[model samples]
Target: MDEMPFCVHDVLNRPLFQRAIVLAGAQGIYREVRWVHILEIIHAAPYVSKHDLILTTGLWLKRSAKSGLEYMRQIIEHQTAGLCIEFGTTVDEIPDQIIDLCDSYDFPLILFRQPVRFEEITQDIHAHIINQHFGLLKKLEQFSQQQQQLILQSTDIPAILRLLQSYSEHQILYLSRIEANTYFPPLPEEMREAINTFCNQQMKHSDQIQEMELWKMDEHRYVLIQPVVCFGQVFSYVGMLLHQAHPTEYMKLLVDYTSKAVATVLLRTQFLEEKILSNQNELIQDILNRSIDSEEQAQMRMGLPSPNGEKYIFVGGIIEFEHNVIEAGPERMESRNQDVLVLIRSLLKRDRMHHVLMMKNNQIYLLCAKARIGKDSESSLYHKIQGLIDGLNKYINQAWPHFHFHIGFGKSRTMLLDAWMSFKEAFQVIELSQTVPAMKQNHYYASIGVYQLLHAVPYPILSDFVQDQLGDLIAYENKHHLHLIDTLAMYFKCMGSKGETAKRLFIHRQTLYNRLDKISDILGEDYFQPQRRHCLEMAMLGYPLIESYHADQ
Candidate 1:
């Protein structure tokens, strides 16, 4: 005989309740267990039904002494296990009427202090309930193990269908995928109507998962579907219609394992069939690759047509995987390819002027659409690119982490291949920008265009120019601890006016003149010399470049 299953009573005996009782002492309520039973708390009469315990504060009795007695009478009529009234709130004394009612009903009543809060008690109760549930799961698992083994070993589909029919009273259909085609077997008229409605709804909403439910046909009526995929290809779907409510957890686990076994069997069958078909399609792969290459050549030939001497600009980028990031694993690569292709297609469809292509090597090539420019054309194009980048980042970030994009825009060209040539130049420039000391040190926009050009110029040549023209003055000012560079820059900015320079620096005019005279003596040249002023101004503007050089070294 099966053992009588454990229930909440087993939970009440656990150590968690003892801990709660200890904690409650800290709140000044010393609790003594009277009786624990299930009772209904959310009912009109507040009657005890199947709950574990009932707790109350005597304040209700204190407000209307007679009603308090009547309240106890109602509780007794409900066959409650026990009652607890905390002390020091409403009723300081237990009235004889309440005691008499409790005595007649044989209900256990206990009293405690005000320190215990109801919240702590609820925690202990839930902990006990969860413990009881886990215990029940263990017992069910032990009983279902043998039945699960039989289900996996069985091969008779008809027998399995009969078993499913007995388990549920609802209309059930088996769904399977074969060679990427979804199949649904014949169903009862009512079930077919429901499924058609569900399929139509699914087709209308791309954002929702495809699922449906049918009810009120019979007791335990429901449907289950299982999808089978092997080697990244879906082959068949198996479904069942039931006439009964769903099974218990143990039974559900058995069904799931059985479904997986069936999927494995079907996969083996498909593999044998594919082996026979492969010999007939020996040249298929070669043909597909050649076709793709031909299409690419055609598109390249038509690139950016010139309209009556109008020119077009081109931009291109290669997405590089970061160090140690393997984004092209077989599973993820397929999905990524699909996603990027869809994105490019959508962008082209939305803007007819734009032409975009995805290369075999995963490089994205784009042509900047040519149009007769009005006043706001450049600004509109810039804003459009900014919005596109923001949208692309949002979509791509969902699948890949740290998706870095390097983009280069080319000058307008009338020839088709000229656009491709511009893309190549921009690509080279981006690469060169990565090497410059200043660009590398800053890291942000290190691969940008103008900064790349500035860095490409020989640093020693620029440095020599500054030193040869202003060496003596620069050295003297450095030795004397004067901000000669800043003073000179500001002085010239003020148009050689002493007072304005002093005001800008928040120093007195005399102080400015004194620094200027020291500057003249150090350089052994006139402070008013135009050549000296010109050299100093150039040096100040080149400060950032100089800093970049030093950082690289």
Candidate 2:
């Protein structure tokens, strides 16, 4: 971070010097230097500016002891960098009294021990300072250009802010103009409120903040605010805080680059955000592919658990749209997909859900975390995930009225190493949900009832198994046009309760008894036996796929 400005300490360390010795006031080494000037005349403070370094031969000091003392005092009063006297030109040695005076004042006094070319020394020193200044400008230029390219390449805003922080090595805080929120190392309540107040007062100009002003909170800490302006108004502001009394020239350049980067991002917000989403989706796929190596790597990729000390439980959600948004041609499908993604993101953001979501294989895969609520009980977690999915379904239904969403979640309280497993399980829940015609929406792997085990069977095998178990009944129903299959499905669903099954079927008890007899005759008298009932339930769960299989054949 550019905490302090260029000082005499920097000049003393330059490679151009022959032998430079500090005589007195070494404590004032931190005194900033604006320019190096040759001051030969006596009482030269009037001509010198603040932080100017005076290089003289001490010929003027040869006049009298009092005059030299007065001249030294003047230099100290004006806050010049220091005195550098070449002894060989006129006076041989610096008087002990003068050195003592400088020491008393804590002023910097330097002695050039050898015969050196003053012209070469002055020019070289100035050139070094200018080069350092230009070097900082070059860095700022490169940073701005790099960030501009990043925007073009669709880097996320938060990632861009992090990159800027890396470049400046300063604490960066981006205040959203719209939300009135802070991002990238978000601050505490008291500090955030104070900063927001300061920014609101400073950013009075709608067009642009006139300059980068260093707002000092104390001797050791300060902030530089640079507004990101668009068109004729300020869209947002970036603050760079450093542990310095004043900011350096280089720090000013950095603040400018930050604001420029922010402006660039704001200008192309849609493209950059979409790009980031697409990239995150790709990252999820890579993680699903088990490409990540460690927890640290996963954290870096995920960027979850907000900076505000938010604890998270990872739950994976799979989105299933009842309507075929994809059948509307590739371009239209892509447009609808983007719209759906936007809707999903908006809803999540509104609810303050921290999530990484992506569309893959015609389903939206989400690894989401809500604030850890109560104990991490499986039921609590499941309900929370269900609630999130339910919210999404509601919003999706509202936005795309014709389309309904069936969302299934996997295990909760999982970490990134186990995220792929959670996603796989959640995806399985969605797939198996097809066989479980009873569970159309908001299903979780652990809560999907009997279908959880049936999910283990391969689809074709499960279809065949269902056919073998229920094929006779299906054939009997088809041949006779009787409502026997429906009656039996309802019978098993009511758990062999004659009264409940009769009530559910809205049939007389005798009619239900007669249907039960017919089902028992076809499947066998052991239909309600424990072992047979288990297979029969599995087959009934797989009935939809079996029917679809026969239809396709």
Best-matching candidate per lDDT: 2
lDDT of 2 by residue, 20-139 (tens): 888898988888987889889996867998889889889878898899998988888888888888877787888888989988877889888766677887898788788888887788
Relative to the unseen true structure, what is the C-alpha lDDT of residue 538 in candidate 2, on a scale of 0 to 100?
75
Reference-based TM-score of each model: 0.33, 0.48
Best by TM-score: 2
For residues 1-553, could you state the per-residue lDDT of candidate 1 as single tens digits?
1111222233335443332221111211212222343322323155455332566666556556577776666665664445655566545667777776666555656555453555555566656556656765674464345334545675444444444333433233444211122223346678576654554443334222232332233454444544444444333334544444433333344345445555566555555544543431222222223332442332334343444343343333333222223645665655665455445444444445454443344444444554546655544554455455555666567545556544444444443334454455545444443443333322122235464444455778768866775677667766877787678878888898888899999998888888888777766666557876666666555555666567778
After superposition, the stretches of candidate 1 with alpha carbons farther than 4 Å from their true spots are 1-311, 314-375, 383-457, 524-532
lDDT for each of the candidates? 0.49, 0.74
| Candidate 1, poorest ten consecutive residues by summed lDDT | 22-31
- Please give the TM-score that candidate 2 achieves against the real structure: 0.48
What candidate 2 gets wrong by more than 4 Å, as runs, is: 1-267, 305-312, 322-332, 370-374, 377-384, 459-468, 495-497, 548-553
